[model samples]
Target: MDVLADINEYLNPTTARWYANRGIPYRRGYLFYGPPGTGKTSLTFALAGVFGLDIHVVSLLEPTLTEEELGMLFTNLPARCIVLLEDIDTAGLIRVEAPEETTESDDKRDFNVGDLTKAFKKAKKLDEALIRPGRVDHQVPFSHASQTQIKELFERMYTDDLPTTKIVIAPDSQSDVLTPPMTPISVEFEKNGHGGEESELEDIARRFSKKVPENMFSPAEIQGFLLKRKTEPRKALEEVGEWVRGMEQVFKTA
Candidate 1:
């Protein structure tokens, strides 16, 4: 299914009203998990752009991110915003066994893994409470990307260009002048396979896809390779074998 399209359809005004009529929270939470560098962040940004929503990124593992601070942040968030919690698995926020008995001073002075886990769980609970429908419209958890998805992402990144153009109209002296454009702009994709320029891009995309191995590397790894060999698609193809070997060696060692 087209995830973005489905999300856009679900975010309509009527959907919100339906949730309200049923006494349900008009919020949604989505979890996207896969390998690292699989375009979770990119997808979140795309969703925000498509829906004209703002994004707020938070790291649960931050040293200063106490429960009170988290509450304040959530309470002050504007309506219709996307909250992204990155590297949630590494955030150490999952519930765990409580620590052994310790004095107040000892607790303040030092915390073991169990103690830290307990604190994080408390903060996570607070986050959960505030991430309901009315305030936070969506909560997205990013995960690894599948091989097919990664290939498609690489194709889109190499072949497609998402550009924004703004046209401003000056105010008339006799009539009421609108300073800013109020209407949302719609972007339509026009396929021009026959066009020379488009054909060249398609060729490049095909060659690039041929060089990329399915499910062997993450999006980030591919991006790094592309950045190094920006104008040399053939070179990237030639060296990808060695690159994959090196990655495998590193993984084996790890």
Candidate 2:
């Protein structure tokens, strides 16, 4: 389906008003499911950008995400915003057989399925209520990016128009060890200096883009790797293949 077009139609002002006039809930819910390394998160980001909406992502697996907290989160959301609940399946919703006997030691044990199920049910009820008319207008599910799309995404990660900084090495004649610069790199290049720096960044981005394989990694995986190498873009590009191989080996062994 043309997901973007469908979302646009659903978000139209007239569509919402029509639902209200019919005494129907105006909310919409979508479910996207796929294997790991898919573009589910990326699609959500794109949707938020298109709608000019702020996104609040909640991880169901978070230990602190209690039922009351979940309700508060929905209650306090802006009139028009995207609320994302990721990894819903892992949120402890599975059915479990309750233990016949209980002891003080049971309270000290990690949360079992019974406890999780109750919490999950409460959260689910809150979700249903929040999605009714006048709240949570649209829900969209994301899937993995295509091979071509994955390549493009990796390319953009490096080539996007982001602020660039230059590192200046100090001479060793004046000191026995390297000293920190008085000014931060961001402050030093607060204003435009020249086109040369931009061109250099673009070059680096291109080099990094070439190193990423098509459909080999998910957006999240690539992002995690880049965050580790944020201080050294060139190093990220140089070592991405090695890093990917190591991750694959670990997974294999596991």
TM-score of decoy 2: 0.50
Q: After TM-score superposition, what is the CA distance of residue 197 in candidate 2 from its true location, in Å?
A: 14
Name the best candidate (by lDDT): 2
Highest TM-score among the candidates is held by which one? 1
Candidate 2 has its poorest 10 consecutive residues by lDDT at 109-118
Clash pairs for candidate 2: 38-144, 39-144
Please list the residue runs of candidate 1 whose C-alpha ends up more than 4 Å from where it truly belongs after superposition: 95-211
